[model samples]
Target: MYNSDTTSWQEVLAAFKRIWGYDDFRPPQGEIIRSLLEKHDALIVMPTGGGKSICFQLPALLQNGLTLVISPLVALMENQVQELRDRKLPAALLHSELPTWERKKNLQNLEKLRLLYLSPETLLSAPVWEKLCQPQLEINGLILDEAHCLVQWGETFRPAYRRLGAVRPALLKSKPAGTKIAIAAFTATADPKARATIQKVLQLQKPAAFQISPYRQNLHLKVQTIWTPRGRRQGMLKFIQARPHEAGLVYVRTRRDSEELTELLRQKGYATAAYHAGLSPEERRQIEASWLGGKMPFVVCTCAFGMGINKPDVRWVIHYHSPLLLSEYVQEVGRAGRDGKPAEALTLVSEATGWLNPEDKQRREFFAGKMRSQYQEAQAIASKLPTQGEVATVAKQFRDGAIALSLLHSAGQLEWQSPFHYIRHQSGKSCSFGELNAQQQQFQTQMTQYLTTRECRWQFLLQAFGFAKEAAGWRCGHCDNCN
Candidate 1:
């Protein structure tokens, strides 16, 4: 009943009103939707709460074909799919944790779906890929939500993401003639480098690019230096006590920190929970539900707590420890003040020198050390990788082989042949050392600058994120520095 022809704008409005109880689209959202409906490729870089989901979801609902959204986190996919199903919309998700019968049922109903959300790894799995490539399946588009993960994790951690560039072409080979699969990538925080990487990797064709600056005027930012670990605990407790009824999140860098902070908060008579990747999916779900449902006022979580979880009225976010990357900081803080109300973000760090507590510096060095070791492993395996083969078999054949292969791909010595295969360059050279290390150090330096800068917090962020014109003489009077 919905179509994207010239007159489809009216249809879009009608659907929006009927389904979402809304009257309009955000800036560039209508334009982005129009482009995708016309089978045009697009790259969208709007920040969080900019209605990024609606831009893709609405178009998918209006089309006859299916839109595959490759997202990073399981929680994210489930949250979105559940929301759509509540609206009686045709959206479903597939992930590792789904029950066998449910997975089978979803697959059997694939053709009935307007949107299907999955991880890049799940998308390229044998059964999933086989079904999607069926000559009868009509995939209208491939979208990368949280597209920055393709840069953040694809290179070293999750190699399947590195092969996504080859997905569209492979799917089209089995599709009927006159079928055009428009490709689009959506992300909340992609720097110029990340944007270029996403475009180059996904091979988007002259996409309609929509970029919104990563500046949130509603979020008040501040950084507090604590001289001792005990002081850090006190600061956290104090921050929580001051906002007794407000819901918020405390971002930490480790699982242990998440749990310890959770205990500290609980002992202070606050309802809180710990969240990290190590928890069972069910446990994670309960915690997510508690916080989202307002049974818990806050959560102490690692980076795993992000992507696809939506709560508009979060009044604050405190970085229990400094993030090692500025992009990460922006993303976590963007989660707050999404309802257009005032929100606070307080980042706690150690004193200028590491004498009192070198925890932050120690963490940065440890992270760098891990990257350096991965580089060494990749270099050792580059000349030894099979000329061409499936990544799963390679992973079984050698230790950390998949990770090594991904590192080599990111270093330019290897290229993806398909979603599950690769071709090593016969240049007779191993992956050169220090490239990944150097990149890691550069990111660390940028994050350090953000933490130590004397400029207005938002101004520093705007300038760092490539909106120099807007950052020029821009200062929010509410930031800690200004106050």
Candidate 2:
């Protein structure tokens, strides 16, 4: 175990240069890393290109015990773990896709790891959770990578995320005394509301915060209105044609859209592919490798495409359809111009109304309907929920009962005692379809407002992300409306 308390900044730089061959830390990187080494909780938000990973990774290596990184994506975990292992760093990742032998081996070696990456689900799985609860595991910190996912998906499909705030406390309860477990949430995109939610949900204890503005001078933003679906196709094609062989990503809302658009582009003699969660892990990796390797110019994909990808020279990003949230828009577009060169983010929209092209509105309606149905399902099962029980046991007895409990927990109608155990209140607080759908409605409205706003695109994004001071009376003079 390294003596982090007496470690000098010079030694930190030596390790950085020796391992990653870097000489300096980005602005707040040094501060964030210092906070982690000192065992202080922190919330870090740097833009996509800002060396965010080094801030935690290096500190984890300098620490005494294992630093558990809770990430949202399997591909991201695998990519990061592979990179560390390639450097001969004592890092490992555990995911469901691992073969039995590999998984068993990882479990056996958990105590020896310096840094371990796993999804929130994997972290809470019985095998991993039991091992973590062991008094001798000697955990030092918890790192939440791509933390915006906790706020974005915690209340929705990925209920496992909602249970994370309890993780540190619950594990500490069974661990040996004097085990200090600090937590840090790291993300490239998070708004003021999202930040507040993360702080509250994680029970962060006066965490040291570092937030950089999402504004990028080199990334030009644009939004075009198209009256027809074919016009939408044409707009994207024109943008790609203008770029002429530059690496980029075309963002879509669904898997079907990814495939359909990829097919259309490929028919036009473009070297492109569809990327979405529907593809097998091997298939996804192949596409990711091809794109990153520059064999494929660009790929049409859903929001799942860009978390751990370190492609620094992505020249452009086009949104075939507007995302439901501004944070998502910022994250996707932020993927471009990472090399500090000029990049362009173009968004194509249907008319202000859905008269000629109805995809955007249809998607909103579809998503809203689904949210309402989910709320009703949870509402129906609320009364039948037990006061306290294992989440998995309830899942076996009732369909979607685990998810319902999750949603109830989100609404203050129930509580998760631990990732595996939950407790529902007998009476008092009640949840509603309307109450649960409120946040989604707000997100839908914000995206629509962004699509139709006549203001500078960069300014709108900056202001949307709680950078009002930086955005004050500022204009890039290059965005669609600015021009």
Candidate 3:
């Protein structure tokens, strides 16, 4: 085992310089690294482009055993693994997209791997989980990259993340006595409630929490409320035209929107492309490469475009449709000003009218209603579910059954046996379905207020995310309100 006492901070610094070519650690990075090296679990919340990956990557190298990094996006996993490999580090990634031969080779040589990056889905797969549980395979830590996705997508889209709380205990059962693996979660956008959800879902044990203010001084935030689709289009065109030669991103709400906007922009003689999850992997990679290589001036994309991208010169980001939640808005806007140069973020919200262009209000109400229905559906299906069953089995049995089970788990009504299997818990009082609906409505209301408020945009965000102390007396001269 590697001894933290013998490995001094100077040694860590030297390694960081030699590997990452960084002369010094940014603000809280050194502290986080030290905590990990000392075998302490951590919850790190930093803004986008804030060296989060390096914090865990460096320690994984300094540690004795393999570090399993759980990531949500396949592109992100590939990007990190490729970068590590480019540096001649022993790193590999396992995902569904991998070629058969490469996947077979990596699985066969698990012992030689130092850093293993894989999605939550692949991590809990039978073959991979079986290999990881072996007594001989030593795992030093588990890093949850982009941890907010645990709260954002855990219940609805990716049910695997909801079961991660049980992973540590289950893995411990297979290891020899006295084996402890530290877990650290890293995210660019997670508010206080989201942070609590991450801690509870991960079952973090007295973790060392680190949070940097989400405020970016160089980012100029603005919101434009429009009464017509044409007005929104014209507003976006004007914004893009003003920054003609610069690189920026225009975010739309749906894939259809992305395609339509891309076509519209092209017709108006702008160089842009549509990016969303529906495209093939090769198509997505090509578009991403074009954007990063400065070939594409701008991309009209959905929310899938900017998770692991590290373009330092993103001059601005325009949201054609307001994001459903404030956390998502913060993350999308956080993509700008990475190089600390002045950047702009403009969000266009549809005006709430009785009949003409009421899309935004209708969308919010639709989502609120959908959330309520889902909660009711979950409660209705909970009793009929087997006491012990696999997530895939339950999903196959009923529509959105996986999500239902995940909601129950989040409400402390069920316990996961593994990622796939779960055992229902019996409590005197069942979960409050009404509470879930109320929370959904509350989130919708907050977003609505943000769109319509005349207050400082930055202040509103800080307050919404439970940073009221910081928001209290602060006036950002860069935001639309202050300007």
Candidate 4:
């Protein structure tokens, strides 16, 4: 199974070793790599440290045309592009960070590149679409990294990923029919519904799906129920104090919480830094580098952080807030113990907040009500607006409620400038009642189950994602719940 002979897969692995200094492929790497090279759409859900980049990077080198990787993080894109270039691979990143002239130069060099990394936000832009529509632009494959965010892991909505279906059409418009572009979606977390959402959003043609389990035996999974704010803070402080100089991550629910917690940790004489989306791109990059390079052992960040984080020695992952869902909880915990060593996964659930809150209940109810309102708004706007400007004006008012617009648009209740912008009428002027009811029911079911489940957290998690439990190694002896 682990072949070293000169087959196409072996040849690719050999080049991989030569470029990245690795002698063997990780388990499932060989299978996924071969599938990608054969020009097939693949949905891969591997845990952290599972060698996801090589699955697409190696294929990019061996393919005839440039490979396009759609990522969600600017820092991640730049880091990946830089890492490839360090190894002398023909790679570049296309993100807003580059100046106009620099971006033009990068695009000009596209004909010579093997891999081009782009933020999904940038890739969904109209100007980018114009370039992709060019007759000369050649993309052999599309690799969507952290693809689960496109569906489940995203907040109330993910507008950028909602536009991926249109991206394929735009790319296909310029390329030859025989080119055969392969699409690959990779993530560390995705439930069954999320997987289905990805397939529908991308319009993949019966894509092959592979999911490795999230349970890591080496990581001790722990949950501590803390009722008081001061008690939770003290518990976190004590945990960090116990570890001293070890690396760790603290994931809070909001940006403000990340900052406050980081400051508290620092005041208590620990090396800590705050990280969240609110930080400048440069500042975020600096904080990430400091942690990754071992300059700091503790970084308090929001759930928005860690999309593409690759630090292998994160000794602990502590959650200050109850994650919106268990899938998110598992992925956040997976970040620790990546170095094949003992690590800690701790969630300090505030008993007052409990598993379900009135606010959460209201938020879900509000989302449902707003979805209906936005659908009607889109329908009304579509009837009146013929030009793009009128459609855009109305869409802007509803931008904060984009999820409502997106679901309506997907359900054939309205149209938009693109999947990302503008509004238009459904071609049929009618709704698919069956489809609408089904999606609404499905999303609601997931939301309810995630909040109410009483099973072993790990078992519930694996089953939600359609992954089978392996031989038992999940009961870490140190977890508070275990004792």
TM-score of each model, paired residue for residue: 0.97, 0.97, 0.97, 0.85
Question: Over the stretch 130-161, how does candidate 3's per-residue lDDT look in tens digits?
Answer: 99999999888999999988987887678889
Model 2: per-residue lDDT, tens digit, 41-117? 99988899788888889988987778999988888888888899999999998888889998899889987889999
Per-candidate clash tally? 0, 0, 0, 3
* List of clashing residue pairs for candidate 4: 415-424, 417-421, 417-422
Clashes of 3: 0
**What value of lDDT does candidate 1 attain over all alpha carbons?**
0.87
Select the stronger candidate by lDDT from 2 and 4: 2
Positional deviation of residue 429's Cα in model 2 after best superposition, in angstroms? 8.4
* Regions of candidate 3 where Cα sits further than 4 Å from its true position: 426-430
* Colliding pairs, model 1: none
Off by over 4 Å in 4: 1-7, 153-157, 352-404, 410-455, 468-480
User: Compared with the true structure, what per-residue lDDT tens digits does model 4 show for residues 158-264?
Assistant: 55566676666667767888767788999888877778878877778779878898767687766665756677888888887788789889998678888888778
Minimum summed lDDT over a 10-residue window in model 1 is located at 426-435
lDDT of each: 0.87, 0.87, 0.88, 0.72
Tens-digit lDDT track of model 1 for 89-192: 99999999999999899899999999999998889888899999999988998999999889888878887888888898888889998789999999988888
